[model samples]
Target: MNYKLLGKSGLAVSELCLGTMTFGNTTNEADAIEMIDRFVDRGGNFLDTADVYVSGRSEEIVGKAIKKRRSDIVLATKVRMTTSSNINGVGLSRKHILDGVEASLKRLQTDYIDLYQVHVWDHATPIEETLRTLDDLVTSGKVRYIGCSNFFAWQLMKSLAYSDASRYVRFVSIQPQYSLVSRQMDREMLSLCLEEKVGIIPWAPLGGGFLTGRYTRDEPKEGRMTTKVGESAWINRASDQNFSILDAVVEAAKELDKTPAQIALRWLIQREGITSPIFGASKLEQFEDNMGALGWEMPTEIWNRLNSASALQDDYPNRFIEKFRRPFE
Candidate 1:
């Protein structure tokens, strides 16, 4: 319900960005509109979507859902995903950036995007060409702000440096996967965003529902870590360590009189420089539950306890520096 300035931009967005990836996939367009109506009723004004979601159907529903309140919402959409198999159909190349924004604008039924983000790192394209095109969008009044998603610290920095040198539109935000169970961003990207003034709108803030406690120690579902994607890339593995972290989350949730989902979200909100997270929900109840994270905060010690349990192993110069500085102590 609270609004924070998005990065260096003067724009204000809600503490929770309503992500529409699940809108057109699991639910019909009508239901998607209903969900958005409920969200806006709850004081949420920020929406995040991607052109590639549901092969553009998601954007269509989202566009329609916000028709009555289009000017009131801070709408964000992403590009760089493969929308077509053709060589020019994807990536952050000038052609794709230009084509993709037009497609997204058409689908969203908006003349300008609140935020236009590169969906992921496009290694094939030079940073200059990609950034230069984003700059053009800003000049053309097609995009208010720019951001990047699923990018590493180096890639983010590389793009920022390119933008600075060319006087192009600097990325005002960075979206990366961050959650209680997945603290990889804490190592570098978070710090990079802090230093560079890039607002962080973390996606998969619940580790794709692993932290939701539905995948209990005894039960694993076909939804997330199971038959579809997991059967290939993921192991059916939650070691004692992972369980210990889950247990701590459950314990804290009980102690705080909140659900595990709330505890997970509250943990992120407590982090410095976190503008908001683009949390996804298939069910209305799930969306309502996530709202609890904003009403109050976990005590500092409890926050640190949860963080310590799920923190990632230090790497590189950080690992080397820790020996000299003793960060844990």
Candidate 2:
């Protein structure tokens, strides 16, 4: 139930954010409402949804669920995905951002968004155009902060540089897919966020349920891995290395008498520079299990064990640069 300042901003948010991507989809409206209630009862006040989630149904459900305590919640949502048949319905162009924010505000039943993020990089639009539009949102009181998701290190740096030079509102947070099984961020994005002072609210902090100890190496279950066929496909994430990391998590769970899901989440919560890890559930039980990730600290030995199991191999400039470091006298 601890709070942290989001990036370098004065805004304080809970260490764990409730993700509503499954609301009105796998989870019905009633269950979603209950989950939000429990989350708030447990001292959580951050909620994340995207306009594109379930064709905006998720936003609608979240809007209804939090109507009573709107002032106490930090709401975040994203744009930049195809929302309609119109040719100008997508991307970070000024047209789309302006249109998207208006639509998001209506669906969320809120006058302003706590954080409005571009879901991904829009190469078609000039960075300046996107930055200016986001700046306008802040200026107009429609958005309090801006952020980006699924961006490369260079893309984020480019946006930050543009914001600094143009005197625009800089991105204060980033939402990346990070977990024990997905350490790709460790390669570059991690260092970039650490240096830039940007908060990281990691999506899929449990590797789309991979680190939840629900799946086996040889048998894929009836969850996203078996049903969805995208970047999170079983073929893509069921590699030997990832299984080893899962094994470590399972071992830690057994030793500590906690679920593998909690172990995996605690690992991310303890990682330096992680602001909050967004977790969602289709059932109330799943949400309750994830809540176990809080209330206790993971022992250093278990944390190190998971870290070593999932550490990515050093490559190129990182390895080469490490050899030249000199000890301070």
Candidate 3:
């Protein structure tokens, strides 16, 4: 497995990070352990979880799975997703940040988190308060690095500028939903991260299994995309545009003799500024299939074909600026 430096940090992480969101949920303890073992055996050292996943059972399962090799793993988790009903139980306030980390550390059975991220933006709290609290976590050695997730371009920049001016630890990475069907990140977040040097760790890299090619246009598939028995699911992702992207992935997979999921994941792995893609699986076989995304490069022609199929349309100022970009170029 090839590793990349996470943003400007010296720490190196695997290209594909094992996501534990399904752990202790659809994935049983035995299956979760098997998947974790196989991932580590295959040279994967990065794992991601969160306090809010399965109401904290996911973190407990992950902690038990990696306790023996804890030192060798780059474990990451998040906060600010309403872990409790208390008035001060959530958000990025200094009180919540401190309380959240203490609980996360205890559940993960680790002294320090490799990377602690805010799960989402909290507009109620001041950005300064959150940045300072995260800096204090780094100062106290409770967190090795800080990151933000699901933040808009302006929110992220505001936090970074505050960190720089206040001389606090800045966010080194971002976790956003990015995949063949979900190119929304490309609209603005992608370029912002590239210019700011923040590593992009894409979550739902397979479009929540839409790009896996298991679900059909008419027939529902047996996967996470399902809502209930005999229930059509992921209707929002069933647009004609996404079908075209899926067909493109299938064509590339056929030529490469790989699965659609692997090709789709490889597309993200090859994108600029992407540090890693957090992939999850309920069964060991699924884990094995996704791990195949590594150890090879996609052919340029096929890569471009998939890229063209999933290209995002420029809007407003982007279209306006592109007309004048040639002068600067």
Candidate 4:
């Protein structure tokens, strides 16, 4: 139920953002409504979705559910993902940027989106074109703030530099897949956000169910992952290093009287410069389980224990720099 500022913006978003990716795809319309109610009941005001999710059904479902209290929930959606076949149907071109907002706004049943994000980097388009189009949106009162998702360090830096010089709308947040099993963001993206004062809204805070502890080394189950059947499901494609950490997550959760999901969420919840995490669930009970991640803090020893278990090996420049780091000279 805690809240944090969305980057440099004055808006205060809930610490846990209820992600709608699972709303229309995994659950039926009735169940999606129930999940939305449960999230609102839990004091969550931030809701994140995208135009491309579930082929745009996600937005329709969430837009219908939020009909009663439109102002209460902070709605966020994204563009830059293909929504149609027309030449102007995708990417961050000025035409697509403006057209995408119009379509997303109509689908969400809202006059203005609280935050509109670029879903992916459109290397084909100029950063200036995207930022200028977004700035126009802000000026027109169609979007409150702007953000980017799945952007690399250099891409984000370049965009920011362009915005800084042009005085266009700047990105207030970055959404990336950050979790116990994935420390890839820790290298450059994390530090860049830290230094630039951008909010990190981590997606897949549970590592796509890898840290849920149900799919253990011994008792792997059928319905643990996002898939319905089969072994080589994308969920089971995790590296050996990831599963090895799951064992430690279970042990620590046992000692702390918590679920691995809670500890996984708590780790990011406690990490510095994280604004909010976008969490989703296929069922109502699962939604309740995700909410349990709040209302408690993990002990320090257990924190370090989980950290030691899931650490990734240093790569390239990181390894080289660490090898010659100077204490005093």
lDDT of 1 by residue, 147-178 (tens): 99989899999989888888898999988888
Clashing pairs in 4: none
After TM-score superposition, what is the CA distance of residue 203 in candidate 3 from its true location, in Å?
Answer: 0.6
Over 1-329, each residue of candidate 4 has an lDDT whose tens digit, in order, gives 89999987899999999898876777888998888887888889999999999999999999999988999998999999888999778899999988888988888888999999999899899889899999999999999999999999999999998999999989999999888887788889998998898999999888777778767554345654646444335444366788878878888888888888888888888888889988888888788888988988888888888887877676889898888999982
Give the per-residue lDDT of model 2 (tens digit) for 100-150: 999999999989999999999998999999999999999999999999999
Model 1: residues >4 Å from true position, as ranges? 219-221, 227-237, 323-329
Instruction: Tell me model 2's lDDT, rounded to 2 decimals.
Output: 0.93
lDDT of 3 by residue, 1-329 (tens): 99999987898999999999999998998999899888888888999999999999999988898899998899999999898899999899999999999999999888999999999999999999999899999999999999999999999999999999999999999998888888888888898888889999999998888888887787465666666422125666778999999999998899999999999999999988899999999887888899989899998888888889999876988898888788657
Error of 1 at 278 (Å): 1.3
Q: Which one wins on lDDT?
A: 2
User: Which of 2 and 4 is ahead in lDDT?
Assistant: 2
Query: What is the Å distance of residue 154 in model 4 from its true position?
Result: 0.3
Cand. 2 TM to true fold: 0.98
In candidate 3 the C-alpha lDDT for residue 248 amounts to 92
Return the candidate ranking by lDDT, descending: 2, 3, 4, 1
Q: How far is candidate 2 from the true structure (C-alpha RMSD, Å)?
A: 1.0
